[model samples]
Target: METGTTTSARYRRFADLEARGYSPLYDDWCTGISDDTELLAMLDTLPPARRQPVLFLGAVRFVGVPLEGFATFRSFVLARWPEIRQVMRTRTTQTNEAGRCAVLLPSLAAISAAEGRPLALIEVGASAGACLYPDRYAYRYSPGPALDPAGGSSVPALDCSTAGPVPFPQRLPDVVWRAGIDLNPLDARDGDDARWLEALVWPEHTFRLERLRAALGVVRSEPPLLVRGDLTEEIVPLVDRAPRDAVVVVFHSAVLAYVDAEGRNRFRETMLRFAAARDRPVHWLSHEGHGTLAGVDGAMERAPEELDGRFVLQHNGRTVARTGPHGQSIEWLP
Candidate 1:
């Protein structure tokens, strides 16, 4: 467990940097919690990894806590500490957001076009494989035309605002095969698992919740192959399963921050080894928080103001764009 002072700083940073513009309720809650010594001490009892604001809040919500003012929220949490703690320990913030596909389309399409072959996607830290079906979902990027699956419109039409020279794809990439690696892959067809996913959505973001449900429906109808194991250990085997005719594309979004530094290095090395051994073309796509991808950040010369709260999109270790956390917007890099 982290010290109370360190935990308090985390809450402050989350409130000021991440929650301020996105969710006012969370911003207020976190800001208040930062100064609440009692609450800080309570939070310090949990495992360090499980003490994240998102996990904590989601656990409480999952256990029937109402969205109320700081005092009420604190009271409910304190009263139901045992229940919330159990939930937190057992669950993770597996935000299987499909909207992220919008930001990823440009890169995926570019790979397919460059290699002149269909893609075989392998997502590390894939929660429910919701993100694996980028080709199945539709996209509507502002200052751009509508993009849909070859057949017709699809559920969860991901809408994203854009800026800069965003490389809008002419069409969705043809993904012939898809698989995912997760420590614990959620079954989209399971009611309990699906409900837990819905509960993970923030309180004020009804739109995100609706989108999640739509994505869940699509995934349930034809779920992708989700292998359960450590990311570094399972990734090579999963990639080897991809058809030789397709180009292997390894990608992830908002997942690596959970991994420690040593683990991240191991994952990087594994990817490099696999890419070198493959006779066919292989592309690596990463959409994670700034500084989350080691070398990718070194190429980014943007001011702190420009990079704040935006995810860094990289392809083959090269910076591509600064994207919104939930795929709301994209600021394409020059």
Candidate 2:
């Protein structure tokens, strides 16, 4: 069978198990089986002596219907065994590449442009506001471009590639505010929230979790202004209150997938209304599924089909950079 088909079958099985109240076990297995290859390989290598213990643990973790509840656990496992087998048959790849890239580079460019200026950055699905700390870190560009903050005061070195070795000047924006909004704002300092954030990280991508931890350290002391509310309900009012002198950039990473079509439409409408009225520059940064955002009758409309696995760096609907899969590496485009 094709890999995609196998993946779908596994997903369905897990979904069914989850629906049938095997969440704990499902979660445990999900967490344990990070790499599909390794997980699939384990199925055949299970020693006879370890079989009962592994099965018992899986049952306890998933159903809370312990080994003592042998009949019930056996029935549940037997019923779902086919799907579980299928799950062990597939491989896992990084799925958040587009989203990660979409949010990172554009925001970095925006922040770089703002320099000394205070800009208000509002992120939808802020989810702990870890990405907001881009200014606090360093970046190494492959093509001899490097940025290291001097004095470690959040002022990054702007190293650009050019003919003459002239120092890249930092241009600071006159900013009056910086904040973020999310339906569920994660407090990195909060233990439970921190754990949830950790759980969301893909097991294969351990670096992401490390980066998240480092970002959290900087943000906890100087927390980004976060509002706990739905973007649809909160964004309009928040935009209305934004200071005119400061540049307003509304961004989201990996969030569009969770919102429905109607929600996206309303969000676009509200942003456009603000843009039209304010005359101040409003930037929308999105790392959503493939599709170009088109200007139609004074509003923006996203194409039904996405740009197909390309990471886009856009500003005011202009494409700045496009890369394959992940955004870790970037090439500048005119």
Candidate 3:
């Protein structure tokens, strides 16, 4: 009957995470704090802005967990709850990690080569739009070629090793134009916005934190054209404005989960209609959870060992790769 009660909505979230094996660490915390008033109140620190699980953890990381143990973690969270809450209110956990570019690079390059020119990328839910500049970053794919930009950014290279007959990218595709649509876009140049982006990275995954900073360095010079609006509403018009000479590739990574079933269907229909109305081909690229994005052939999903994590990379509705949630690496489908 209270926010602190196990049956209350807030405590239920902790219970859900515990039930699902999110982490032994989280499972332990959820179990420990299920009835603790101080801890429950700490969880409620952030205003009603829909904070993600990572926000609480990141706060400890952001403040430097001082010492390990559950006691230390709880103290840090309670001590800095206000600061964490402020950030949670101001920054959405829109972790736009670019590590995925490594998995996406081969397909994009292939598509660009087949077209004999560059491709204009249109990313929906392009929070901070870091993934939009995959073409501009350098890459190292194990058991394959090393892909690099003409004048590569000093930003840490995207290292993705693939299995099977996946063809290594000959080169990064030429990106003639690019744009991203977001409800609230974060500018890489803005210190606070950029800091929040870095904060969103999971605490233990230090490499991811490094990658975010590296990515920010690469795109800061030439800021991405990120428009503020819903994906379904802003995508088509932005696509219309892109260079007719270049192919239009509509893409998203780990974003469709935010959209309801109807919204996802509407987004799919919108792209189909936009392509139908245009003479040039409009390729749609999706890298999301297995069932999060529709049109994956059941073959990939049916395979047992191949699926490592939730996310799958698809090219125009066909499954290409089953990947880790953050694209730490991937298992390419031949």
Q: Which candidate has the top score in lDDT? A: 1
Off by over 4 Å in 2: 1-117, 153-176, 291-308, 323-326
Candidate 1 stretches with Cα past 4 Å from truth are 273-278, 295-306
Give one digit per residue, the lDDT tens place, for model 2 in 68-156: 33345445545665443332232111122222422254354555475434566777777777656545555544454455444453322
**lDDT of each residue in 185-299, candidate 3, tens digit only:** 8899888788777666754557777888888887786777999998978887898889989988988888887787777878877766655655677888888876565442231
Model 2 local distance difference test score: 0.50
Model 3 gets an lDDT of 0.72
How far is 320's C-alpha from truth in model 2 (Å)? 3.0
Q: lDDT tens string, model 1, 196-246?
A: 898889888998998899888888888889999989788877877999999
Q: Candidate 1 local accuracy as lDDT?
A: 0.86
Question: What local lDDT does model 2 show for residue 131?
Answer: 54
> Using TM-score as the measure, which candidate wins?
1
lDDT of each: 0.86, 0.50, 0.72
